[model samples]
Target: MILESFDRRTIANLEAALERVCDGRPDGADHELRSFIADAMVACAKKGQTTLGALTEAGEAALARRGISDRKQA
Candidate 1:
């Protein structure tokens, strides 16, 4: 749950990274980029993480807008 508590700044960084991975390709991202993003998300989900709910929600909404759903398995 701590990952769910990440601060705004941290979430911003993660969002930026996600964006980078998403926008790096001309046609579209490949499997490698997707895996990298998934790994980054997993790393971001570890305990002790602190994220702002508002920021996280904003990021989630953005991802949804882009059709990039969270791949984090429950």
Candidate 2:
């Protein structure tokens, strides 16, 4: 479906944006930006804007790859 494709693209864009916001700093830069991304993700989830389980799993996997876990707890 066209909507499915759009959702996939939007999810990918959001993930990439989150990655860019997360890519450096031992202390971690940009809390506000990160929070904004998180909020956006939550909003998207609430609106059923994308596949929640897949998006969240992908995000968790990305965090794990970065040597981080418990992203929500972070």
Candidate 3:
């Protein structure tokens, strides 16, 4: 599996990116957003962009492409 190819910290970066973006959202309400970040992170890893910064940026960019902002509007 793709995950088996990644180190713990690298995978943690993916989770960290999600938590950062999805913070304060109700449970079960972030499925779509979570998937987007996960997919983007994997795609980045597959393309050899495995740095934490690169992966996090990729996740954020993916959300932006979907019109999902980094922080929820007040």
Candidate 4:
């Protein structure tokens, strides 16, 4: 677990995950959506999911739950 304390690596991973998931979104990408992704990453970290892949997956999953698609290349 993260002991509920986030470190540099943890923050970096979450940020990377957020960026990856928000890549296809509009310029602003909607504050609510971004907040949701960030919240998801935090939840995952609190659950001992700190790996970059895991965090990214969690963020992506949050987007999916919001009915958002991976349209990065579209």
Instruction: Name the candidate that leads on TM-score.
Output: 4
Clash tally for model 1: 7
Q: For residues 1-74, what per-residue lDDT tens digits would candidate 2 score against the true structure?
A: 33453556665655665665467745346675465455555455546545545445444454454444345557
Q: After superposition, how far is residue 65 of candidate 3 from its true place, in Å?
A: 0.6
Q: What tens digits encode model 1's per-residue C-alpha lDDT throughout 4-65?
A: 76666676656665565467456246665455554545454454342544334443444454
- Candidate 2: give the clashing pairs: none
Candidate no. 2 TM-score: 0.34
Off by over 4 Å in 2: 1-6, 27-36, 41-74
Q: State model 2's lDDT.
A: 0.53
User: Mind giving the per-residue lDDT tens digits that candidate 4 earns over 5-71?
Assistant: 8988998898888898899778427888899788989999989999999999998888887663556
Estimate TM-scores for all models: 0.37, 0.34, 0.69, 0.78
Tens digit of lDDT per residue, candidate 3, span 1-74?
Answer: 75698888777877776676667656424787688778888899878887778887887788777664535552
Which pairs clash inside model 3? none
Error of 1 at 70 (Å): 19
Task: For each of the candidates, give the backbone clash count.
Answer: 7, 0, 0, 0
Candidate ranking (TM-score, best to worst): 4, 3, 1, 2
Query: Top model by lDDT, which number?
Result: 4
